[model samples]
Target: MKIFVARLQGTPVFDPAGDQIGRIRDVVVGLRLGHRPNVHGFVVEVQPRRRVFLPITRVRRIEAGAVIFTGRINMRRFEQRTTETLAIGEILDLTVRFDDQPMTVYDVAMEETRPSTWEITSVALYKGRRREPRIVDWGEVSGFDTLQKDQGAAGLIAAFESLRAADMASALHDLPSKRRIEIARALNDTRLADVLEELPPDDQIGILGTLEPERAADVLEEMGPDDAADLLHDLPEEQASELLALMEPGEAAPVRRLLTYPEDSAGGVMTSEPVILPPSATVAEALAHIRQQDLTPSVAAQVYVSRPPTETPTGTYLGVSHFQRLLREPPSTQLGTVLDPSIDPIRPQFTLLQVAYYLANYNLVAAPVVDELGRLVGAVTVDDVLDHMLPEDWRERADYRDE
Candidate 1:
């Protein structure tokens, strides 16, 4: 048998003798990974402002808005366990993204997987006045558990681990300020950096403001230089300076350089941590270097081959070796031998449009940025260029592409 969780709420539970026990207030279910959660029990309101737990095993049948029980119910107050989530209090009526559209959950439909074990199977979404509510499988929805208070910050963060940073940020944006802050506080530095980079300026400021100064600096360091710089630019100069002072000099330098350029310029949006290799580096060495560092696919697409002194960007810009070329060439082949020098790098002051055209014309996912002396300083990625080219509120739109 199947029933909507919303319908179950407020239904009267009767004992074997047909005496009314109480009205159902909420249903509790234990969360499980890779499987539908089974209902544990129900919170039944026995009197005004009083609720008690009635185990599912005690219930004989549910019919016509009333639960018939086979045994006497425990009169003790309902106490939620760490693993339990309230179906009505936590999940029902929450906004979830479904079928590429935002939908409000009107009710959750549960199926009895076993004789006494019921698990949530689908959600009924509110459509319109004349239309019947749309039923969607539970797996088809995103953001369903994002704002579940029972999950706490750690559980909620784990539930969102599979989501892209942008998707997570979008979901978090809809939560109340208090919940958002609590979740933010629970995220590790690297994870927080990724989410912060995806959020809007106001949200970035709000979350960062909640963190301690040193902690905020640590998160900034973990982010790409361009993203960190952008966030710092939006903050008050004094506050930005304080945070910068807390960061390691090496990590802070690139952001400082990026801050010197106009926000929409190539240098401004370019990440300072490109895979730069000395001209002497062999294909094998380059591959090893890339493997050692955690890089996004776009950033790892190529490695810049520059002149000597690899540590602090002191070399003249030579060219780049695409990852495909590296794989095709022998391991002993020097990067300088197969460098693609035809692609001219973008200048610090180039406008966003110029950067876009340059990347498009070169058919490159990323293009290096150079100073007046023609030294490699950073690389502007296609994603960053498009981010600046798109409308300011594009992130808030339901159909916005997060890639």
Candidate 2:
């Protein structure tokens, strides 16, 4: 019997013994080249706030208010895989072309096609506001591969609203490239920039390539200079230069300087916008600056004391004042008075291992990058060093999916 996926959502799921285990969040369906999508499983929100994949094969039966399953269930967190779409999260409310006519999807239903195989069987579409949704066989509409281009990404973005940028990037990686591009287009510049930083180079370039040059430049501006440079480094020299030219002069300057260094060097991996302050600035003022919402924990770990110019490429590097030290000192005290002069800064040309060693040796989360003229150029965080040292595919590691 076909059941509307919308109704299954939030319904409690049970084990063969009738013990409540979780509530259904959505159904995972695998898109086929030219056929109805195969029902892969259900996304179940288990006790204590974990969501895991429950294969359809394990489900004993589906009822109006409950779903029962047999056998053991793995409790590993569910990570969306390639071609697996979330029916409730991604399909419902999507505006797609049905028979060359644009319509909003209201519901989708699935049924067991064989002893253990289930597939989405039909779709409910809105033909008119007052009329009951038009139910049509799923096969009548072209495969989602064809419909993906016409669908808006609002529903998909909503599904990812609660996910961190890294988790969201993982979900985006699992989508078909076309849909991924579509969703990327719909995200605001800052959100897209954060997600882009978490994505691999190939995916970053692909998404960046699809945006209009001006918007792409704006998105790049929102990304960390190191990340922006890294993305541009992978692009053709001409295209990279064009995008740089389109970015605001101040934003482009740091990235341009970063692009000149080898990708693995300390300068290349460092952020030019670390917390910097004049020697005369007070502890109270330094505390307020680091409190900015956008400051990453690594960047906020310490505030560097400098002379005259406080921005990157400042006059003279004084010393560092860690957040802990700031909290312990009197608020009115000058930053220079409390600075830890013993902490050494790394040079721009330090190798990745050298940079890692410097941070490790000092037991510091971030270290300033000093230039030949004794100017503070940038700062490299431990996370930045790890990002360079880890295997290229570290983000895609499958250990999280081990069941």
Candidate 3:
């Protein structure tokens, strides 16, 4: 059997009991002085974001999207030796001389020569980014001197191109700190913002610290106001203030407002941005608004009906129009007609516990916050509440996948 190392990334690895242990993160290959590199094992990311080595001898089958294996995993974290190379992470993007032409390494194909033993047999090289890669004997390519030079993060990012923001963040977190910063620097502001929202506060601050203050502010602006506020809350007051000051006035306004309330208060946890619209907006308009690519699932599940002003601190709060209602009503039906205003809005001063009980009582995925004038200020999602309720390092904790 032949498996392309790049494709093995993120593949689920199952144990003898058919329970998934973890996902494949990278392939560990030991380079010899000459001949093809020996495939040692896989870097399997287990619980708690730990990457452990899985010897090829333990692997029983390599099928679509899954790697079935026998025996109990050691669970000890894997550390790369200087003599070892990561197939997907290190070798995939290396430039090599194949025949007389210089080509970019795109993938390394591992062939099972006999029994459970595997070896790197060939590599897929791209003449150019737009061209399809051609497979050539692994020995044909030169420059595997194993010299560890700083590689462009483009190759690393490309390997994670298919992942969602959360998945991408996990993949990145597994990388070395320097590499993580390198990749973060390569990502554009908007993309970086999305991934940062999924990462823990510490990781967010670490990567943000690497960027210039101006770029850091731009990334913050791209993030959800609530998320940006939460991240800033983690930084030193002076540093946070500097980044906020660098942000555009209009973009910084909402985040600044969010930061004023106590971290555990309703206003602090609520996102200043939600699918908000005037009462006159039609059901179809609400649906279209929620359909935006950037809207999170919880936020998109409902729309806020308000008076004239649509932005946060909107005109007198009307009620919430759940997406289900939008779907059931006529496209031209006004949101105000079917809006659910029976449930009272939470005040900015409400405690996290109070907000949680309110949502639970109303069976709400999200609840709106109102000020003294009854103006809709923001909406607090269940996710936001849970985030604050969980241990600060919950993201750094073990994955529940093993359970």
Off by over 4 Å in 1: 1-152, 399-403
lDDT of 3: 0.87
- In candidate 1, position 152 carries an lDDT of 40
lDDT of 2 by residue, 313-376 (tens): 8989998999999999999999989989788888999999999888888898999999999999
- How far residue 213's Cα lies from its native spot in candidate 3, in Å, is 2.1
235-345 in candidate 1: lDDT tens per residue? 999999999999999999988988999998988898888899988889999998777656877788999988875543548989889999999999999998999868777
For residues 159-274, could you state the per-residue lDDT of candidate 3 as single tens digits? 77777788788777766787788888999888899999989888999999999999999999999899999999999999999999999999999999999999999999999988
Q: In candidate 2, what residue range of length 10 has the lowest lDDT sum? A: 394-403
The TM-scores of all predictions, comma-separated, are 0.64, 0.76, 0.87
**Alpha-carbon lDDT, every model:** 0.79, 0.85, 0.87
Candidates 2 and 3 compared: the better one by lDDT is: 3
| Candidate 1 displacement at residue 348 in angstroms | 0.9
Candidate 3 runs further than 4 Å off: 12-23, 43-54, 63-84, 95-104, 125-135, 140-149, 399-403
Lowest-sum lDDT 10-residue window in model 1: 150-159
